[model samples]
Target: MSDASRHLDARSWKALRDKSPEEVADFSTHLSQPCEVCEAFLERSDEDDAFGVESLADEALGSMSTPREDAVGWARLRRRLWTPRRAWLAGAVAVAAAAVVAIAVLPPVASKEHEDRSWRLKGVAPMSLELSAVARLPDGTLHAVTEDDLLPPEAVVLVRYRASEVSDAMLVLESPEGPAQMLGGYTLEAGTHDLKEAGELAGVSLAGEHGPRVLVLAAWPRGPRSAAARDAALTQRLVPEEAAQARLRLRVEPGYVAP
Candidate 1:
């Protein structure tokens, strides 16, 4: 271990790795790090290397071609240094004796403190969108909305179920005239908390698993559509009158309620 290694922080190491592959390869060769306990152990090992050299010398002397005096001298040293008691003491140290008993007796437990409160989509099947986008907002919150800024007009809409306790409920459905309308309210479970907020929405028009051919207001990114567009799309889809029915009608349901 070296002083330079001790002064280098984790961020600096990460930055070095972010360099060109060729640069990183070369940088790693010059990188140095120090672990105090390990360093001390290594220093002790170097001081004790005399025994290692002596053992090697003994092995050489024991070869069939060696003289009788050489073989006897080395074998005597091997017995004196590698005693059974010394071997047992080394094994105890290697096992980290203080932690062995606790590890052996303790049982693993699952606690509520380890669980997250964020809303999860549960088992919603993922969509295969070529322009799929994802983002995590500031304040430790996550927001995944669509990004159609660069998509062509020929691109098709992808449907997905976006659930999270940190956010509000929103749904949008699109009308045939390119306008988006609002769907009804929704609720979600954030761990044990019930979330019943005004739903934020985006337009979605896709066939469901069954052959019934379904369209609904999905809680997914609207891909650059404004709030009004989204609201209109939902309204047209969810509140279509009998005489003014659109291609598809939607019934928004708050999927679950948390305890």
Candidate 2:
């Protein structure tokens, strides 16, 4: 549970000790605060002598905001009343702290790792139906698709939305070579690429496509071969087939294309 989940104070714990059995049960069940101390007091059950219990209460109340480990002392006191196992003191505290850390910290690390793993050379596949297709053209014209200037800079292609649309497309790369350098236009440097290599880099899922999808990793500007020759050469010569999959319509010519 989070610190935000509950707030237990000295008054709350005192009330539990003084209350009847039914009241104690209600308090325990309704307690959103740390219940270990209150529970321990209840376990002692003989409230007639307030000496030891009162002092413990005062100490516990003072340390409410202290580190959880210190707080564990009161929790231990509560546990001792019910389960007299002398062996579990160290282990249970460790488990509770670990649980807290896992809940509070592990999720963000996993999320970032997942996000970083998403972008690479692999093509985007459709994951759901919400992503609607805006346009489709024959394979011949596919290589000549216009760059959606309005889309975000990272957007290499636009699936369905008009010329420029915000993209959710993700890339994953796999070949021993790094990201296929963008030469220019729909042309690419010739190289071998495959599902095994690219897939290992990362995976992307479009809104509709269910299984693995293809991606166009590179392209060149339309012109005489000599005009954009360097970019065209890199796009056609160096970029690997496995690197760019022409699975979806690109808003811009990726300069590199699959052979």
Lowest-lDDT window of 10 residues in candidate 1? 99-108
Per-residue lDDT tens digits of candidate 1, residues 1-259? 2233432234434444456464455445544344564345444543334236447767888874845556456545644653321111111111111111100111112234423522222222322111121111223222232321222211122223323322223334453444443434343332322112222112232212112222332332222322333344355454322111112232222221111
Q: All candidates' TM-scores?
A: 0.16, 0.13
lDDT of 2 at 116: 40
Candidate 2 structure quality by residue, lDDT tens digits, 84-191: 211112211111111110000000112333344322222232211111112112132212223222111112222211111112222222222344323123222123
> How much lDDT does candidate 1 score?
0.30
> What are the per-model C-alpha RMSD values against the true structure?
30.3, 25.1
Model 1 stretches astray by more than 4 angstroms: 1-148, 152-156, 159-168, 173-179, 183-186, 191-203, 206-259
| Clash totals, every prediction | 19, 46
Candidate 2 residue-pair clash tally: 46
